[model samples]
Target: MRAVYILPALFVAGVVALSSVYIVDERKQALVLQFGQVKQVVEEPGLGFKLPFIQEVVSYEDRILGLPTQPIEVTPADDRRLVVDAFARWRITDLVKFRQAVGAGGEEVARQRLDRIINAAIREIMGGVPSTAVLSEDRTALMNRIRDIARRESGSLGVEVIDVRLTRTDLPEQNLEATFARMRAERQREAADEIARGNEAAQRVRAAADREQVEVTSEARKNAEIVRGEADAQRNAIYAEAFGRDPEFFAFTRSLTSYERAMQSGNSSIVLSPNSEFFDYMNGVTAPVAPEVPAAGQ
Candidate 1:
């Protein structure tokens, strides 16, 4: 009978021992709570003890955690609306505070609260800047700013925000077509302005070229007329000089020239008298002699 009692006592003692002890995993921290109050926090990975049935151990991830936020629309300083998607890296820093802040709710409650804090920080920071800043490389600074704000706010919840990143920032789908159309119209207007300016410049150049051509042609014609007048004057002077040297010979030569021209046509329809001066050379008449040319010594 004593052996049976001893065996039952031993079984109860074993059950109590098993229930009082817990293993803390390397990647997680634990919190011991009794009657809805935090009694102890186990930060390191090892064996821990608590009351057999009155205390419960809650384990939370000690490693870095990830929280992806939902896409939210934000209006920047320029009043341009954009859809933003972001994520955060965080970890529980104070297990006691975490348990106290999210009593009976645990990591799930903490995550929800953290998500709100991050979203608020994103909106607040992004709303103050222009859309260009949000889209540019300066976005890294913006993310750092968001992380600081989130860290400050989430400190109350016992979580440290390691980093915050904006994965995607874009115009809303409804605005995409309108934005594209506006951009196209603006570019077309610029192109048209450029074309009009080019045409105006071309017209100016053509006008200048035409004016130059007219001026050059007029100057060339003036020079040609002057040259022709000079040549005519020289020829008349030479004819006068020959006439002065020998008037009779010159008259005979003129007569001969006139006769050849008057009878050049084979038809020969000239009704000139036989004694006409035009036929003086052709009639073999003796003409006045020309004065002899003086010798070089004379």
Candidate 2:
């Protein structure tokens, strides 16, 4: 009977010992509750002791958790609709507040609150900027606003919001295709204009070369005519001096030349006056000498 009574007490002590001690790691927060009521919160890493069987320990993540906010279709101030992908990194900053307002380690409830806060922030800040600016030059400012608003709104929820960032912003495919077509057409027009200017320059060069060729050929022909005229004048001056020295021989020579030309090619008709230059060598024919025969076998 004594052994049985001691045995039950020892078992109870063991259970109490097991339930009293709780450990909080460096990356976690611990919450202590007594009979469903908040007792003490452990925000630092250590061993925490609580009442056995009546007290409960709840653990929370001390490090940042990535929470992807719901993608919402929002129209910017310029009335362009886009889907916004936003997420935040946060951690539990207050263990007491986490257990008091919302249940400790209540990820679902926390996510619901974040969703509300993030949506409200997007509507106020990102939705106010034009779609062009939100997706481009003003994206940094918009992200800053979202982070600020989320931090402020979540401060009371025992969560510390580190930052918010946008993942993607895009124009619809149809819009992108139309933009490409316009860009291509503009480039083609510029290329065509350049080609036209090039062709015009080439034509000008060719025309100038053609005109230069014509001028050079004409100058060469004129120089050739001048040389031929000088040669002809010199021949006439020599002929007149020769004819003055021996008029009769010159006439006879000239007539003989004309007769030789006339008899070489024709037995055709001819017309002449009696006193014409063609008669200058008529009736003054000379006999030709025959070759002498060789004596036989001398």
Candidate 3:
């Protein structure tokens, strides 16, 4: 009987000892709760105490945690819609407040609320800026703005947002084809305008060249006519000098030259008198002859 009582007592002591002591690790903090109410927070790493069988200890991570939200659609001031993928780095700052707000639901509840806060911040900040700015270097500023808003909003959950980042931003798939088509059309229109301007310039150049050619041709013809007239005048002067030097020889040579020219034509019919001066050189007659018609039968 003594041995049975001693064994039961020892078992009760062991149960009590196991229930009263809790361990906290360096990577985590603990909350002591009594009857579903928080009694003390164990922030340091080591052994801790609690009432046996009546108190409970909850552990929470002390390091930063990532809360990634689902991709959300947002429209900017430029009226362009985009899909935004983002995430937040955060950790518990106030253990007491954290316990009151999210200690019960633990990391799961904290993530849910933090996701909502981040999404709201992203929507509000992105909606105020143009899509071009969002895609530019200004995106850094926009992300910082989101982080500030998220930190403020998540403060109620005793969570401090270390940073907020936008991982990927893209135009909606449904709008890509339409946007590309519009850009192509704009480029084509600009190319056509350039071609038209170039063509007009080329036409002007061709017209100028044609005008220049006509002027050059007309000037050349005028110059050729002047040279021909000068030659004719010089020939007449030479002829007069020859006539003055020898009247009889000049007249004889002129008559012979005319006869030779008339006879060179194969089909020419001459009805001149047989004694005419035109044939005088051929007849070797020096006397002037009267003009006469040929006999009717001859």
Candidate 4:
């Protein structure tokens, strides 16, 4: 009978002990609440104590978190509308403040609210900058401005914004076709200019080549004339020298040469007179002999 009573007493003690203790993981912090009022705050990891059956613990994450907002359309200072999508890295810094502000709504609700703050900040900053600035090197400065603003504005929600970034920015669907058409036209104009420049250069080269050809041909003709004149003068000089050596012999040889050329073919026709000077040698009529001259003594 005493053994049975001892078992019942031990079981009662076990229930009481289980309700008094709670385990907090390394990744979490806890708040002990009683009767809907805050009774204790547990930040450290491992086992913790709470009133049995009457107190409850609410756990909150103590690590960095992410909040991604949906893509939204924004107009820039240049009046260009763009579709923008962004995300933010954040974490709950003040547990007491966080719980007081939005603990009941939990992490999901907090994220929703954060999305609004980030979107509003993005629009405000992006709207003041030109589209070119957002797309150029100045984009870095614009993003920094946005992050600073989001961080400052998120402080009221007991959250710290670590970084803010835009993932994508592009023209709206309705504008894509028009933009592409304009780009094609610009490219075609550039191509036409390049072709015109190339043609001009080619014309200059062709004109130079034609001029050089004309100069070369004229110089060749001039050189040919000079060579022919030299040859004619040389032939005349040789004839004059031969005649001075022996005039009669020279005339006889010339007649013989002309006769040989005229009689080359048996059926060849000749219209010259038989006694013509050309046939003097062939007719056996030799050149006149020089009259003998007497010595001075005779």
Clashes of each: 0, 0, 0, 0
Which run of 10 residues does model 2 get worst, by summed lDDT? 289-298
Q: What TM-score would each prediction reach against the true structure? A: 0.66, 0.68, 0.64, 0.81
- lDDT scores in order: 0.87, 0.77, 0.86, 0.83
lDDT of 2 at 124: 84
Report the C-alpha lDDT of model 3 over 1-298, residue by residue, as the tens digit. 8999999999999999999999999999988999889899888999988999899999999999998898999999999999998978999988889888975799899999899989999999999999998888557889999999999998988889999989888889999889899999999999999999999999999999999999999999999999999999999999889879987777776765555565564555767787766666678777443223233233
Candidate 4 ranges beyond 4 A from true positions: 247-298
In candidate 4, what residue range of length 10 has the lowest lDDT sum? 289-298
The C-alpha stretches of model 3 lying farther than 4 A from their native spots are: 1-68, 95-112, 129-136, 246-298
- Stretches off by above 4 angstroms in model 2 are 1-9, 205-298
Better model by TM-score, 1 or 3? 1
Ranking by TM-score: 4, 2, 1, 3
* Model 1's TM-score against the true structure: 0.66
| Regions more than 4 Å wrong, model 1 | 1-27, 30-40, 45-59, 99-110, 127-145, 246-298
* Deviation in Å, model 1, residue 91 alpha carbon: 1.5
Q: State, as a TM-score between 0 and 1, how close model 4 is to the true structure.
A: 0.81
